[model samples]
Target chain A: MKKTLNAYSEQMNQLMGKAICLPHGPFSELHEAMRYSLNAGGKRIRPVLMQLCYEAVGGKEEIESFLMAIEMIHTYSLIHDDLPAMDDDDLRRGKPTNHMVFGEATAILAGDALLTEAFQIMLSDALRHGGLERIRAAHILSEASGMGGMIGGQILDMASENKTIDLATLDCIQLHKTGALIAAATKMGAVLGGGGSKEIAALEAYGKYIGKVFQIVDDILDAISTAEELGKPVHSDEKNEKNTYLSFYSIEESYAIAKALTDKALKLLEQIPGDTSLLAEIAETLIKRKN
Target chain B: MKKTLNAYSEQMNQLMGKAICLPHGPFSELHEAMRYSLNAGGKRIRPVLMQLCYEAVGGKEEIESFLMAIEMIHTYSLIHDDLPAMDDDDLRRGKPTNHMVFGEATAILAGDALLTEAFQIMLSDALRHGGLERIRAAHILSEASGMGGMIGGQILDMASENKTIDLATLDCIQLHKTGALIAAATKMGAVLGGGGSKEIAALEAYGKYIGKVFQIVDDILDAISTAEELGKPVHSDEKNEKNTYLSFYSIEESYAIAKALTDKALKLLEQIPGDTSLLAEIAETLIKRKN
Candidate 1:
């Protein structure tokens, strides 16, 4: 599992490095800012999940562009979420956020550039490949990132700030906020790999369960971890008065919930005929991850 | 010409009103904020250019989605440009900016939503239509709005603020910032309308010249028109210390330059073997408009 994860991560790093090469132009600073956040290390979970799902469904073609596009979307969301007008965090991954290093205006443009470039990359790929599946993948990605998905989740999260919300509402927020992209990753991978509808639906369901687990674990980490350990400010959810799993249950209870969700995700993986051992390992690792 | 322009404008308004209809969700406010700026009366110039070029190139399909998508991109740019960290303007089109009414966080999300939704609309269309031409058109739009184009131009514009830049640098900024999208409109229209490469190239040249003329006229209007006449703050270029045509030339010289560019654009139209009378009239009207 570790070997596969490492291989996928290395490939993503290489592809992303080439994806955003700085052009010899006046606006190279925008590219630099975009690279700054993108190169800042995260777990590479989304792209890895996408690759694993693609391979699990017996995908043979290279999907470097789609992998890079999903990560770009994730990175752009973080940059904007860290802006002064939003979470206003100065640190991400134990380093200065994009806005902190590049200033607000450049950071904003960097975020916009990343999002626009994601579509540009996808559309260009579609033009080259000339397939409905690629276009469908791009459409799924856009829907996940747009109003009906991440953006909508963000709005709900922002509105819910400074107040406690019920479990159903919290579920709605996390489902769209975090689950949409995760689900998109698996679903796109399945489509791009030419999986049957049943396999795609199963993986999508698997993704949703794990997305909930991921966020619950995040809330738990925020409550218990130190700033240095988490690579970001601790107790941020509390700082923003956000509702989390911790808002409704104790740490142990939250852990149990995550475990149950992971079990559910793993069960869905079993229904797939392809090799899903890597996906199962990912589900286990996500629940036990400290950061 | 006037009759055609009004017809396009009315169609655009109706389509745009339907394009962003409020979704029944917790985040309907995001939709409202998007609709606010989108419905705020700009000249609907981008979509009109797209449609005129579409007709001129003998397009016959319902391109309502692309028209709405282009306008959504334009509106999103405006919302972000008016942010406190950017131009910080309180007024746009004689109404309070998105941030002023919806607050900065929502305004930012609204901008992100519009940009994402633009692609969503386009990708959805591509899915339904299943053609390489639509995909090519979408790629053009994305490139125009991405780093090498509009956003890149924005970074140049921002860097040039509070400084005296040369005319060459100013031209680069305006060309990317404004001309890219305008050029994309005509080029995309030609492609979607099934025009040959020769016709597409000709309309693209036409669009680029008009884009330059459009920006020069904008600078002149900012220098001469009142807030009431322009429906937004005037002399804002001076306030921002940004370079414009007036920075290097007097009003008469700027007007002459715009007129010369308009003539060049009109000549480009004449080369295309299609109905270009409306395009020619648009070029002539652009150079003489008050707002």
Candidate 2:
């Protein structure tokens, strides 16, 4: 499973590299800035999960565009999140952030362009494929990552900074800021894979649970992992004065919650009538992830 | 035609007010920032033009979502464009800019939310309407407003700042920065209205011409009008060291080009078999406007 995950991550990197590369466009500078951050390596977890979900649901047709599109959206979010006006981070993925390399204006434009480009990729690919499924998938992805989902979550997180907020409010922030897009990626894969209502619902449930697990684990990693291992700053939540699972619960309690959510996600996957071993293994790896 | 334009503008205002008013969302601050600029009151030209194109092509179904969606995208651009990172303006439509009112972080989130919300509205509406047309329209708008269109143009415009750029670069800036979205608005109207390929092509051409005319007049107005009259600061082009028609040609020559483009837009409208007088009148008014 680990070997397969690595292979999938490698494939996604190559695909995203090609998708974002525009060598001779008039706005090549903007494209360069976009590529600079996108190529800054992460686990490619979102796209890999999406592809794994699709494959688990018996999908065989090409989903490279969807894979690339979701990664673009994730990359854009990271770029914007690192802006001086947002998280104000200097480094991301162990490199100078987009603004650090390209300047603020170019970084902003790059983020904006990448967000818009995601829709363009989805739409053009859907049109080429000639189906309503891609459109549905696109719409689902947009809603999940849009105002009510990721952006909403981000706003909540920002507003809660340096303030004592309740667990409910903290839950809202976690659910939105990171959870929504992760759920969208998983659900979108199921939808595109032509899963019925039952399968779709199960996958969505799986996504939601794992999303929680992912965030909780992230908070734990931030608390324990070194910057060298994390490839980004450590204790960012503390520096940002952010409320995380670590803020409200002990390390053991946080790990328990992550474990429970992973169990929930795996159980949901079990209800789906498909080979979900990769999905299950991924969930296990997520909770056990060191960085 | 003036009365009709006023009526459409009013209708758009009402629709936009409702669309942007998310009374109890978790991200109400972001929503407020979005509404701060959205309700700041422009001529509602894009939505009005979309409606006119729809009506001109004999479209009768409710297009409130598309109308509101385009306006949201336009408003988001305005919000981001006014950010400290971008134009750093204090005023828009004679009031404080979104960032000025909501702070930089909220304003940025607001802009990002609005962009995503545009897609949400279109997709949800399309699904409810049970047609591929809305999805198609959404695609066109995204393409026009995305990398190779508005954002691309913005990048070129930004990169050209504090530098001596030629007429070709200037043209690229104008065509992309403003033209693509305008063209999208016009073409989207025809598309949603069920206009055939010929009508769609003609409307797209009309949008391109009017978009050029509109930007040229904007430059002229920026050069000649006051902040009070224009409801925003004048000489911004000069302040930013950005090129425009006035940068390369005499005011008279610039006016000639705007007039020529407006005339061209009207001619294209004439080629389409519909009541296009409103569109023609709007073009004339845009070129001759004092503000």
Candidate 3:
């Protein structure tokens, strides 16, 4: 499982690097900024999950472009989230954030460009394939990233800032913010792979459970880990006075909840009737992940 | 021609208002900001151009969604451009800019949401229709608005701030910045209307000329008009030391250049075997318009 994840991550890294290599022009600075943030090191979890799910469902088509598109969306969200007007973070991945390295205006444009480019890649792929599947995949991806999904989550999180909130509100925020895209990763993979509605729904449910586990573990790590280990500021949720699972439960309790969610996710994988061993391993690993 | 244009504009206004009606939620503020900018009055030139071109090619499908999508993209660009770190304007269309009214963070998310929702609307339309034309239209829209088009132009514009750039460079900036989306309007309309490549090419060319005419007129108005007349600050280009048509030619000369471009665009419309009279009149009016 580790080797498989590394291979997917490396492949995504290479594909993403090639995706934005335009000739040097008047907007080369914008491209540079986009590339800088895009290549900033992370686990490549989303794209890897997308690929893993694709394979698990017996997909054989080349989905490199879609993988790159999803990562671009994720990277763009981070770029804008780190803007002076947003999180105002100076560091990400243990280095200066996009706005810190590139001026704010360029950073903003870079984010816009990445988002636009994601659609461009997907639509271009749809044009070549001449099918409804690509369009359906795009629709799912867009809704996941758009107002009702990731951005909606962001707004709810911001609106809840400096105020204590219940576990239900936190669940809503995390589900929209992080769960939408994570579920989208698996759902898109299933759709593109021509999975039936039943299989797609099961994987989607699995993705939801794992998404919750991911977020809860994230909250736990933020409360307990060092900045060096995480490559971003520690205690950021606390600093922002944001509500998290930690706000409602102890660290041990959070871990236990994450473990339970992982088990639920793994159980869903068992019902999928495919080679979901890797997915099962991934969910288990996610609960125990240190970073 | 004026009546027809107004008809298209009014229809677009009604459709756009309906397009973004989200049920109130924790992120209702985001929706409000998006709707505020979407409803902030403009001529709806891009959508109108699209619909005109669509009819010019004898298209009879329901394209209200596509029209709304284009306007959404345009409004998102405006919202971001007016941010404190970008153009930093306080007013737009006679009201406070998005950030001024909604605050910066929500403003940024609003811009992000608008762009995402544009895709959401377009892709949803494609899913219902299930054809390559909608995908093709979406590809064109994304490309025109992406790094190589509008955003590219913006970066160049910002990079050239306070610098005495050459006329060619100014043309490049405007072509990417303003001309790309304008051209995309006609091209997408032609594509969606099932026009052949030759017809699409011709309308695209016409769009390019009118796009230039629009920018030249904008520069002329910025140089000569009042803040009240334009509903925004005047002489902003001069204040920012940005190059424009007025930088290289007197007002009369700029008008002459714009008139020539309009004539060229009209000639292209004449070559098209359709009811291009409205497009011709639009080009002519564009060159002569005040605020």
Candidate 4:
């Protein structure tokens, strides 16, 4: 799994580098700020998931741009979420956040640039693949990343900050904030790989289950992982007075929930008639990950 | 001209309202912030131009979403530009800025949501028209709004603050910051209206010229118009220590320059075989306006 992930990461780094290259103009600082967050060396989970889902559906050829676009969106979200006005985090992926390095206004513009550039990359790449495939992929991605998905989730999380909330609200936050983008990644892979409705539906379900597992396991890791292991500080939720699965339940309970979600995802993979072993492997690794 | 602008503005308000409606959930505040900025009442110049270009190129139905998306992009840009970390404006369109009313964090998310929703609205509308049009329109809009476009221009504007820059640098700032999206609007109208390549090219040229006229006129307005007439504070560029056409030239010279650009745009309109009278009239009104 490490070898596979490294290969995907290497390819993604190259693609992202090319996508973010700005002209030697006056606004080169924007490009630099964008690259600072993008190249900060976290696991390329979203891109890898997109690729795995595409391959699982027997797709090969051109999926690099879509993968790159998804990662840009993810990176932008992280950048904005780390702003002083948002999460107020100093470090991300073991390095200073974009706002910490670039200042507040530049960080804001950098995030905005990344979000806008993601669509440009999708559209430019669409011209290569006849057009509809990239359009459909972008559609799914935009829906996931927009108010109905990630942004919506962020507002809910922000509104409920430093306050107690019910499980339903927590679910709402997690589903929109993280789950929607993950689900979009898989669904886009299915559509881009030419999978039919059935394959798309199955992969979407798999994505949803794994998304929940991913967040819960993240909570568990934050509670236990050392600073070195996690890169950033541990128990950030506690520091921020933010609610999490750990705040509501014991570590053992979080682990059980993650395990059950992973199991459900793996079972859904079985129903899809493709070589979904890579997906299953990823899901297992994701939940058990230490960093 | 008022009647024509009113009709387009009315249609745009409806489309924008529909596009921004969230599915009654935890993100209602996000929705409200977005609506506050969007409904704050601007001239809707971009959407009106887009629709005018569409009509001049003979397009009839299903352009509403594209028009709405363009306006949303414009509104999002305004919202972000008004952030305390950015332009730090207290008033926009005669009312408190998004950050003033909703807090800085929520304002930021609102801007982010509007930008994302622009794409979602385009893609959803595209699905009905077989897809490529929305993708292409989005491509133009994103390119005009991204790093090489509006955001790029903004960074340059920010970096050059309280400093003197040459004509070339100033032109670059204006082109990227304001001209690009206006150009995108007209070009999109041409493409969506089914104009051929020649017509599209002509409209693009027309858009570029009119964009210049629009900004120069705005600088003129800022220099000369009253707060009540402009609906915002006047002499803002001077207060912000920013450069403008008036900074380099007399008011008479600025007016001459705007007239020349408007004439060039009108000449381009002559090449297209559509009813461009409305576009010509708008250009004249825009350049001659007191506010």
Candidate 5:
């Protein structure tokens, strides 16, 4: 999985490189804001999960474009989440946030533009190649990104801040806030790869489990890492009194839960009736990550 | 046309009413911030256009859900546009902006939740009454709302704040920021109406013209209307030093242009085989409006 991840990062960079060339907003500042966040760089895990799952499921299409789109949406969320009115963070991906450099107004507009542009790219005939798979992919992406999924989770998380949360309540928040998108990524991959309903369902289940693990890790990392090591300011969740997985579980307990979730995700891969090794490795790599 | 419009609004509300009942997010101040702007009264112009075009094209499918989705998208844009960090406007649709009501952070999230909810409503089975038409409608809505159109125009409009814009630039801004959604509305109407290539093309052409007409009227209203009468504060364009059609063209001349564009739209409708009476009446209503 680590070897695949190295390859995945390279592919992601190449794909992001192509998408970055597309025309941006007329406002130079807004464009700069978007560029700053998008180019700041990260593990690019979302798109990688999408592409690899896509390949495992028979997604031989122009997979790069769809991957580019997921990345854009991911970038948009970060840009907005880091805004003064949102997360109020000063740094991200080892650099100043969009608002820190371009001002809040431009940062706001830039995030808005990136979000809209992500959908625009999907709607374009050039990107979709007019295939139903891509169109379906777009629909799934929208569902995952919108209120019933990531945004819904975000709302709940924001509302829950400074409030005591039970384990069940916290689990629900984490599932929607983070798990929905990760699940969507894998589902999109399976569909793109020509996987049938059963296969897609398996991948989606796989994603749901893995997505939980991802968030648990993020919560853990938030507690343990410095801004420099994590590439973003830390201690905010505690500062804002936001409860995450780590808020309730001990570090060892959180680790155990992440491992269990990863195992569940790997188990689901067997339903695909194909080579399940690659996906298990992806799940393992995710659970084992340090930064 | 008025009857059709009233019917469209009713249907859209009825459809939208169903989706929000589901527990998607924490029902708190932030969620309320979104619902406040969303459920507030306004013309469902986009839905009307979509249904109108759908019917005009011999499309008999239930498009109510998709109709609501587009309206939600439009409403979200308005909510966000009125944010302090963006337009800093105190009023929208005759009431205080979301930020004014919920605070800036919650307001931003409210707008975001609405944007996400719009897509969720469109994708869920709860709103999936139109099938293939749903996909087509989504494609149209996404493009219109995305950067290639409305968002693009927004970037231009925001950039134009306090800066003089040329006639061509102002026209382009209006064409996108305001016109794109209108175009989408009409084109969606034509598509759902079962209009073929030629009919869809004609409606789209007409849509572009009326899109211009709608903006001209708004510009005119802003210049002349009082805040009390208009609901929202008036002359906002002038206050911001933003360019408007009225600024680029003489007030009298822009009205002349509006009349001309309305006429062009009406003529295009004639060529498309739709009920010329309804189309013409709507155009005339737009051209002759007092508020």
Candidate 6:
């Protein structure tokens, strides 16, 4: 799993580096902010999920451009969510946010660029595949990263901050905010790679469960992980007084729930009728991500 | 011109209401903020241009899904631009800005929603036409509204604000800030409707010229029109102390230059070897607009 994740990290950095080097002219600051966040050294779980899902469905590693598209959308959301008016955090992924590094305005536009670039990249990537594949890819990535998906989740997350949430509310927020994108990453790979609707649904369910488990584990980590271990400031959830699963569930309770969810996700993957090692690897690996 | 414009406006309101009405959770505030800006009156120029260009190139008005998309991107830009942290405007389209109406955070997410919704609308819309056309439309809209296009121009606009800018700098800003999306609207319409490269290029040229002309006219209106007449606060150019064609050229000179650009645009439209009255009417309307 570590080796698999490392490969995605290396490829994504190179992909993001290419994006960063693109001529954004005087908007270079905007590009820099986007690059800063993109390269800020997270686990690149979404890209890996996308890659694994593709392979697990009898697909290959050649659909990298689509992975790049999904990652761009993910990066854009992070940049915006970290803005002063949103999460109001000064630190993210162990460094200053786009707004803190570039001015707020540039940061805003930088996020916008990464977002728009995602579609642009998808179109180019899909064009090679032609037909409905490009369209399918666009729709999947858009739903995951856009409103009612990542952005929608961000909206809910922002609204929920500094307030307490019940278990259901926490579940809802976590599902949409983080789970939507992660789920769509795999589902999208399936759909774009021409997997059947049944395969797509199973993959989506699997991704969703794992994504929830991942977030819950994150909450558990926040209750225990050190700043150095987590990369970003560890105490941010408490510092922000944000509503999280940890806020609602005891550490033990959350861990149990997370474990259950991970088991369920693996079970769904098992239903996919393939070797499923890659999907299993990703589910196991994501829950263990430090940063 | 009025018929097509009115037709699109009516459909847009209908679609906007439908999309917004579909529950996006407690992000209702975000949707409302999006609605506030989106529902606020404007020319509905981009989407209409897209439709008109599509129709002109033998496309269908079935492009309704894309109608909201271009508008969403445009509205999001307006919302973000009006942020106290961004352009810091109190008024837009003769009404309070989104940040003023909803808080800054809500407005930001609202803008985020609108932008995301743009893609959502595109995807569903694309599904209607099949993936190939959808991919074509998505690429066009995304690129136009993305970094190399609108956001890039906006970053330049922010950087150049209240600062001395040479003709080259000003032109770069104008091309990006305003021209890109306009060009995208026309070109995308052509692409979706099966426009040839020459036709696409012609419309592309048409869109670019008219976009610049539109901005110059906006500057002129800002200089000469009253608040009530312009529907927003006037003299904002002077207030922001931003340099524009009007600041550089006499009103009469600017008008003449605008007319010449309009002529160039219309000429390009004529070269496409098809009905271009909608574009021509739009060109004429650009010069004739009071605000």
Which has the better lDDT: candidate 3, or candidate 6? 3
Write candidate 4's Cα lDDT for A154-217 as tens digits.
9999889889999889988999999999999888988898888898999999999999988888
* Candidate 4, B136-184: lDDT as tens digits: 8878998999999999999999999899999899999999999999999
Q: Which prediction has the highest DockQ against the true structure?
A: 1
The local distance difference test score of each candidate is: 0.92, 0.87, 0.91, 0.86, 0.76, 0.79
What residue pairs clash in candidate 3, if any at all? none
Best lDDT among the predictions, by candidate number: 1
Proportion of native contacts kept per candidate: 0.94, 0.73, 0.96, 0.80, 0.44, 0.76
Model 4 interface DockQ: 0.79
- The deviation in Å at residue B254 for candidate 6 is 1.0
> Per-residue alpha-carbon lDDT of model 5 for A1-291, expressed as tens digits?
345677878778777766645454464555666667777767787888888788777666667667877888888888888888788899887788888888787777677777766766665632336446766777788878876677777778887889998988898888888888888889988988889999999899999999898889888888888987888778878888999887788999999999988888887887776666667877998877767
Query: Between 1 and 3, whose DockQ is larger?
Result: 1
- The per-candidate TM-score of the B chain, in the order shown, comes to 0.98, 0.97, 0.98, 0.96, 0.90, 0.93
Better of 2 and 6 by DockQ: 2
Listing every candidate in turn, what is its Cα RMSD in Å to the true structure after a full C-alpha superposition?
A: 1.3, 1.6, 1.3, 1.9, 2.9, 2.5
In terms of docking quality, how is candidate 5 classified?
A: acceptable
Q: Where is model 5 more than 4 Å wrong at Cα?
A: A1-3, A23-32, A125-132, B1-19, B23-31, B121-134
Q: Which ten residues in a row have the lowest lDDT in candidate 1 chain B?
A: B1-10
Rank candidates, DockQ, best first: 1, 3, 4, 2, 6, 5
Error of 4 at A32 (Å): 1.0
Q: Write the number of the candidate with greater lDDT, choosing between 3 and 5.
A: 3
Poorest 10 consecutive residues by lDDT, candidate 5 chain A: A122-131
Instruction: Report per-candidate DockQ.
Output: 0.94, 0.75, 0.92, 0.79, 0.44, 0.70
